[model samples]
Target: MTKSDFPALRMTIDGGRLVPAGPFDAERLNSYRRGTVVYVRFTEEKDRVLVRKWFAIIDIVLKQCQTPWKNRDQAHEAIKLALGIVNLSKTVGGDYMQYPKSITALEDPELQEALEQMTELLSRMTGVDVATLKKETAHIVEYEDHGPTTGEIIEHESGAASPDADEPPSSSSAGAAESPSSAAPTNTDTTETPVADLVSVETSGDGDAPTPSPGARDPETQRLIDFAKDVLPLAANTETTGSLLSAIEKEWAPEIKKMSADGQEKAKAISRSMRAIFNRQASLNGALDFFSDALGCSVEELGG
Candidate 1:
């Protein structure tokens, strides 16, 4: 089943059927009165049961690792690390690929503490923060100068040709005091000269390129880009991504409804990020604006 079917619970395939995992304590599940024992029933062959169950565990752990933290950036890093760990485990078959065990192998005490840590972190990361994370992770641009200025090269060449020049340069010494006693008068003029050369070289090589000015991108635009790069990754799987967007909608929808036209405009920008799955664009926009404005910042600020 999709994340929409069960808002609170995280679902993964277990025994060839989807089963809820994560922070839904027994009390929370019992309150819903859904059923006493939550087990997955599959029609697949008996031999495949264990394999499917193991897959389910892997999925759940992978999903959990991607869950956001109080600091969205940190959470995103955590998720990437988690994904890497899971991917590594997949390379090695058997019980080592199981859920909580696989996650625990990372030796992260924070992850082991409680499943709610993921939800709490995501909630804490503001839009601006998410935006910042996105910008940081985006491709790096390099800046370069084409070549040295004409005057600089000329001066360099002139300096380098000094020793071979026809004209002899003047000396600064005048009315110098004579030595009281000298064994012999030396006629040799000793000069140590430094020279600069106009070497034909590519100052800006193929690898060196100028970075576009930050001003080229609007703050809002950059923030949006960042949100896509950073926050989206936290929602590693389809279910997590959907749930996160849903949570944003549910929590901020009411506030969004009360926003002004200008606020609405900002909301629209945020809606674009959720366009793929968020059906209620208007509502999502409003909700995003509300959250941003409520926090005395833009959506970019929160996502950053």
Candidate 2:
């Protein structure tokens, strides 16, 4: 019989035998054939709770911000894109495509990493303090035990659960949770110099590209340079590149406003480095030239 003929069953695997956990139709149990293979799905309540908390955090952030995204799914995709939590592939037409992995499927370590990244982005976007947000959202996941004990039994031949199936449908969109892949599949090609790898670049000793002198080294500038290198590659491939830049710019504005003239000049230099790195991925020289022109200083100033 087809899977549809079998009744839904919730059971435990005890010593290689299926032990029904609760009331199940006895009539349907007889339908099982000897040696017939049945599929099983194990559910992790902790993971489910974490997913709930993630959506809750997104809901709070979306409610407080004026973002291009209209709903949590869109916001989730945007955050993943900006943070580089996605896979890349090319279409037949040679356009790039991003497949943002569903957070529900992430392993524990990856899920923690995603939580950290999402929290950082949400804080930057909404001006909400990360500590406060974390404290407020921590208790938001109220677990319900109404469902089949921790694991559920199934009769499916093969395949996996839909990414969209993990969460309930949102009011912003009907039916079911929107999958990340549901977004536009095509993207403009952004292949250029790989920005992250350039952090290790050594000066060739030729006048072609000058290395920063040790005397010019400033801890703060070095920190910004390292930050810029980490995120620039992720930003370049996203259609919301402007959005990422705008968020960082927003974060920098107030700090810039409070600086003294000299401090403001230094802040401007730092800002130039950020903008240059984000705007031009064409060549190393192009990015450096933009930084130098904007800073109106020697290339070595990038280190300070």
Pairs with backbone N, CA or C atoms under 3 Å apart (clashes), candidate 2: none
Best of the candidates, TM-score = 2
Evaluate model 1: give its lDDT. Answer: 0.31
Quote the positional error of residue 7 for candidate 2 in Å.
14
Model 1 worst lDDT window (10 residues): 192-201
Candidate 2 TM-score, true structure as reference: 0.41
Using Cα atoms with residue i matched to residue i, what is each candidate's TM-score against the true structure?
Answer: 0.18, 0.41
The ten-residue window of minimal lDDT in model 2 covers: 190-199
lDDT assessment of candidate 2: 0.47
Candidate 1 lDDT tens digits, 203-294: 24552212224466445434433443333333333355566766765565565566554344444434443542132212223333333322
